[model samples]
Every structure is written in structure tokens, then in C-alpha cells.
Target: FVNRNAFGHFGLSQDDFERGMNGFDMIAPEDRPRAIENSIRVMRGEKLGLNEYLALKRDGSTFPVIMHSTAKYLDGKPVGIRGIVIDITETKKLEAQLRQAHKMEAVGTLAGGIAHDFNNLLQAVQGYAELLLLKGREGDVGYRELQEISRAAKRGGELTRQLLMFSRKMESTLQPVDLNRVVEELRMLLERTIPKMIEIELRLTGNLHAVSADISQIEQVLMNLAVNARDAMPDGGKLTIETRNAIADEEVRRSQPELTPGNYVALAVADTGQGMDKTTLEHVFDPFFTTKEVGKGTGLGLAMVYGIVKNHRGYITCVSKPGEGTRFEIYLPAIAGTQATPPVDARETELRGGSETVLLVDDDDSVRALGAELLQMFGYSVISANDGESALQVYGETRGGIDLVILDLIMPGIGGTQCLERLLEMDPRVRVVVASGYSIGGQIERVAEIGARAFIHKPYDVDEMLMTVRGVLDQE
Candidate 1:
């Protein structure tokens, strides 16, 4: 009650206090009237104890504060009011963050369920279409129609993967990646795609430490961020992408709860554009949350980026204010001693048929039959099993002849990983390719750790199946 530190804590100086700064001056403009009424009640000895208000600071910042006020009297004469104010800025921030997290988690659960079912149906559609393409003659009417169907199914598969990514269910291959190289490649692509009004500037720092991450996912993050920056600048603005090495110690980790103490590669995207207010920035990464007009955005760009970064064991932070533009900083853990692995070109490898025996196991009857038929068409003999238990029995019977196993990840009895472990125990040299329609982030890694030779996602074509089979078999 006697100290002047309360006002000083709100950024007010001694000069302002001497110049007749009052409690009303400390209240935000929109909240001043309510605060004045409450103060009047307290002065009247009504015992108005605690109230929440937006408090204004000398630096023009507003924060939530809990104000406790009571009238001080000397012998029945009211002299003044003694009050206490406690800032609730951190409390409000945590509440907002918890709400946003719960919202995103709910959205992700729904999206993942939908995408998982859709991928299964899409795989069936794509598989039958590919089989039809093999039988149909080139340039025939039916052949062209089947090609269109295959293309559309492929597009649908891509959409499902994107949804899975946003849901944090998609698997990624994390490898040492050079962010500078990724940025350079995206620069060329953005140059051709971005609007003429927006200028793309690359401030890539050389010799940046390599971060372990999925190359394609990182590319997606950069592209999505760049696209977002482009959209923020409706009239015209400069978009700059900068990279640097950063280290997060105890203090930094405390501030960014998502991060731990480690060396990190910092990738920042800054834009001089319309910018965002505090309210808008809070929900930027929420699934399907967007500011763009209808038909302009799907609102999954930043959400996908958020999922990818979190899946890669990284942290992302956004900073913005109205009329001041926006910046997003992504920090990925950096490895100590490894050269960045160059991204592999996705060009189609030659599809060659092989004369070998394969065991195909899947709980889905349609998938199993399709896989078997495709393997046979590829000039290979295939043994089929309807479930993991049957698969083990069949492998036991055909162990001497079977060269590879195409094991479905999800099965009725004895799941993929369990069946894989049993198979490895039975035959330590067993060459198996794990296949699935829906996989969590680390399913492929689990298969690899169990000695699986390769993995193919469901809905594979004849060529893709044959190529994968041959690659796995040829590996010495």
C-alpha cells in the first residue's frame, strides 16, 4: 500500500506517478469505465474485493490483471483506497495454449480416422486400376479411361497422405538434411509459382549444421510457409527465408516448453505483409483455421507444418503484430558429425520381373488376392495367407522355397510386428517387405529394426510391386 512499485511494474515512471497517474489511468481504455465503477463501490465501503481488468502499461502494452481494492478510513472518515494488482499475462497465455492444443488434438483424431479408412478404399481402387491397365492395349479407349481412373486414385492417395500428415499419423524417414539446399530448390520453384507482386528473398546461411529430418516433409514445411507468406502480402511484400545455427540451453528450453537443451538448426520465414494480431496468431496452426476467403485456402498448410515439425522432434514459434508483419521460426535438432544426405530423385526405376517365390500375408482378402495376382503376373510364384497365424504356418511349410514375404502391417491375429518377429526367429535370413494401408509414424522403423528388407505402402501397381520385389531380392 505504501510502495509505488506497483505502477512502476506496469512500466510507469516516477515522473508519471508525480503527474497524477491514478488507478483509472492504469486501466485499459475499453475497461476503464468498469474499473471506475468497481473502484467507486470499494470507496463507498461496499467491500469490492477482486476484479479482473485489462491493465494498460506506460509502454502501451495491455495485460490481464487481478485488482483487489478496499477503502482505507481514518476514524470514520474515508481517506483513500488501498489496492493490489497481480499480472495474469502468463496465466492467460497458458489457458489459451491449452485450449488450442485440445482443439487441435480433437481435430487430428477425427482426421486420422477418416484418412485411415479412405486410404484402404483408395488402395483397392488403385490396385484394380493398375491390373486393368496391364491387360488393356495402349491407345485403346478403355486403356485411356483406366489411366484417368488410376491418376485420380493417385491424387486421392496423395490427399489422404496429406491428411495423415496433418493428423500426425503419416510415417516419415528422418535423415540428415541440408536446409540450405532445400531452400535453394524451393526458391526456383517459388519463382515460377508465386505472384509477381511478391518478391522471394533467400538469405540462406552457408555451412549450417545438418538437422535430422524428413527431406520431403521439410520441403513441404518451407513451401507451405512461403505460400502463407505470399498470401499475407496481398498488394506487395518481401518474403525472406533465413537459416542459422542455434543452441537452446536451460533458459531457452524453459521459454519454449516444446524444446530441449540441444544444438538446433534455425529456419525462419519473415514477411513484410498484412501481419496478424494476437488473436489471429494463436490459432494459426489449428487445423482448418485460416483467414483467406473461400476457395483461396484449405487451412491445412500451417497445420501440416506443425505436425511435421513436431514429428521431427522440433519446435516452431510464430511472432506477429498488426501492421508489423509476421515471422515463423522453426528449430530442428542438429547432429554433430554427419554430412547432409542428398535427397533421392523420385524418377521411376525400371520395372523388371523376377523368377522368385514370395509369401503374401494380409487380413484383407481383396488385398491378399490382388498382391498374389500381381506377383504372379510379375513372373514370380506367390503363397497367400489370410492372417498372421496362417502366415506363420504357411511360411513354416514353404520356408525352403519362399524367397521374400510381403507382410501386411495390420492383421486379425498376431499383428505385423509380432508375425515379423516370429518369422525372423524361424528364419534369420528371411527377406520380408512390410506393407500397409495405414501406418503410424514409426511403423516402418519398427519393421526395419526387426530385419525387414523393405516396405511398400498399400495400393501399389504391378510395376511398383515388381520393382520393389526385385530390389529387395537383389540385395546381398
Candidate 2:
């Protein structure tokens, strides 16, 4: 034993050190028994010497360590024990990293199959939208129906994008977000959505945790869950939504390796309707596994939710039984932060008005006529071209007086992207807006970077067309 001065340096009293209890209290709760037993074994002259255990701190937090001890003797009688303790926290961390990597690799393999099929569906949707709008006459009832089809096709296109995101093939902006406000903001729309026969209730808790998730993705998951619940209870029932703080402890880590033993937020949606048996519950999360017959359900509802949650580094659980109800729970990591603010709402999203002569390019004549008519209705002078080469011919002949240029990205010969390059060469100051069916790989999202003021998706409404045209013209 040493003086009190020596004991003070180690944060222990002289008596604590002498009684062999100084390190005993430092052993973590779960490892303390084994550590103590190993000490007794060494003292009794057992052949074993070294043992691995966890040491705790003043804050009650635990870290792994390998404690090695040897018996000290004076005159053939044991007097004291000298031991060396090496910290192993970093080693445990590396082990966890290896396990997580393997988990992601397995998920990627499964997601690849889903993405391939989804792409084929998207191509059909894009191609059909191009055809339907082509067959419709302006201001006719048939044209309005075609416009609806076009809108649906675009949403289907977005679904495939989400699938790519789930496969980790698409890019995302990761940031800290507060989930509580997101649910709060969407409350109005949800209330209006559910039928009068169904009861809606919200149980939102305060001091709730924030998670690092994409806001749009989280919204999509919630929307999907709501829609699934709505479909489950076609006869009308109670739908409950809840948000709360949770901790993924040792028990949880066993089943969900994606979760860490820390704070989290649980977003759950429950419905009181005809629930599924064990057999149905097992396949509930699988794609196209809906119990709803015929054209009622696509079966991709839960699958989409599953994909989105996995992509966010989270897990989802489902509880149900025959003649009862079902509850779906999602857990996302809680990182303390505020929600990202929404962008300004645009009045219109398609190209329309301009008194200045405009150069319009599209391989399809139907999209061209409708696009031209929409612009003309907004009081803008419209000049049209059937393909990329014709667009350049018209632009060069007009001597750069074109107020705006709207280019369709997909074409028979020189593609929209290549056409953009040729058009920019003809008039460097040209105000352009890229229009696509999402088949052009972010043709709309990257319009500004390509020297265009904006991007517009096809099947444009007259007002939306007018608004986009006004906004771009105003910018010029």
C-alpha cells in the first residue's frame, strides 16, 4: 500500500486500495462478477492468469478491458497482487463495424433484384405517357383523361427513384431532422384524407428525439403507412398514430443490428381492422404480398416502407393476428436537431407565356402541339421544331430573339442531352427549360447547372405552364 497522496492520484482512498476494492467498483455491472471470480481464482493459485472484462467509469458507463494479474509473494506466502489492465473499447468498436458492413452487403444483394424490375415498369410508364398525351386533342375531355394518366406515370417514376435510393444506388443529402414537426405539419392533409366513418387520433409526445433522416423520405414512409392503414379498414375503423422516445438496449440489439444502444424515435401507425394470421404476417413486408384482391392493391406499400426504413439505417416491426388488428412500428436513430425548412412554393411548374418568339423542340408531335397550345393560350408567341436539328435551324434563323427554349430530353436520334449542347452553342444567352419524363436521369433537377433557368416535367396544367413561363421570363 502507498500513502494517501498516491491513492489520491488514482481517485481512490488508501483504505479502498488496501482492501482490494479500488478496481472492484470500477468493473461494469454485467462483467463485475466474472472479473471478481477470476481474481479469486488467481489468488488461490489456479493456473489461469488473464481475463477479459468491462470496466465502468464514475458516470456508470462501461468499456471493455483485458485485466492481467500475477500473485506476489514474500517468504513463499502470497502478500499482494500486481495487475495490468489494458483498454479494449476500440477493439469492440472495430468488431461492430465489421458486422454492420456484412449486414449492408446482404441487403444490397436483395435490393438489386427489386430495382431491376422497377426500372422496366418506369420505362413503360414514361413511354405510355408520351403516347397518351400525343393522342389527345387540346381542351377535349379525352385530353384531360390523358393528363391524369401522365400525372400517375410521373408518380410511378418517382417510386422507382425511391427504390434506387433504398438500394443505395442513388444519392441523398444526409442531415439532422426533427420528426415531430413533420407529422404536425401533415396533420391537416391527413385529416382531410381519411373517410368520415374512420376515426383518427394522434398521440405526439414532447421532449421527443430527433433523427438524421431525409425529410422527404420520412414523409413518404408516413404517407405510405397511412395509405396502407386506410386500405386495411375499408369498412371503417380507428387509425392511431404515435411518436415517442425510445432506447435500443441490449435486448433490442440482438434482433436489429442496424440499431445502436442509444436514443431513438418510434413512429407507429396502427389500424383496427381484419388482421392477418401468422402465415400472412410472415410475408407482409414482401413486395406484392397484399391480401387485397384484384386491382385494389399493388402490394408494394409495405415493401416501399421497408425499403425506405432500411435505407435510413433503421428497422421496422409488424404485429398482427387473425380477426384482430395490425400495428407497424419504425425506429429511426435520434440525433438532436431541428427540421429543415421547406422551399418556397411555386405558383406554376411548366413553361407557358412569352410574347418573344420561342424555340420548342420535341421528337413527338403530340407533346409539341399541346405544349405550343398551352403557351399560346397564355398569350406567348410559339415557334416549334420537331427535332434537335430543326430547333437549331429555327433558332439560327431567328437571330436569338427567342424569349425561351423548351427542349424534350428523349428523342429518336440526337438525344435531349446532346441537343441541349447544340442549342447552347447556337445561342449562349438562350433561356432554356429542360422537360423530361424522369427517363433522362435528373434532366429536370439539373436544369440550372446546364445554363438553363429551370426544368419542367411534361403533362403540364395550363396554370402551372403559365406560372413557370412567367417566373423564367421575370428572371430574364
Number of the top candidate by TM-score? Answer: 1
Residue-level lDDT of model 1, residues 331-362, one tens digit each, is: 99999788999988888788887889989988
How many clashes in each structure?
Answer: 0, 0
Displacement of residue 177 (Cα, Å) in model 1 is 2.1
Q: What tens digits encode model 2's per-residue C-alpha lDDT throughout 1-476?
A: 44454344335575665667666776778887887787777778875756888777655566787778877879997766667777777677657556645664566556654654554455455545545565567896677777777678677666556555445444334567667788887777777888878898889988887787777778878888887777778899998889999889977776555688888899999999788898888667665578888888766667667767876778788898766888999998787666544533545355445576666787766667767765665567899998887887788888757888888766767876777777788777778887653332334435456786766644443454567667877884
Candidate 1 C-alpha RMSD relative to the actual structure? 3.7
Clashing residue pairs in candidate 1 are none
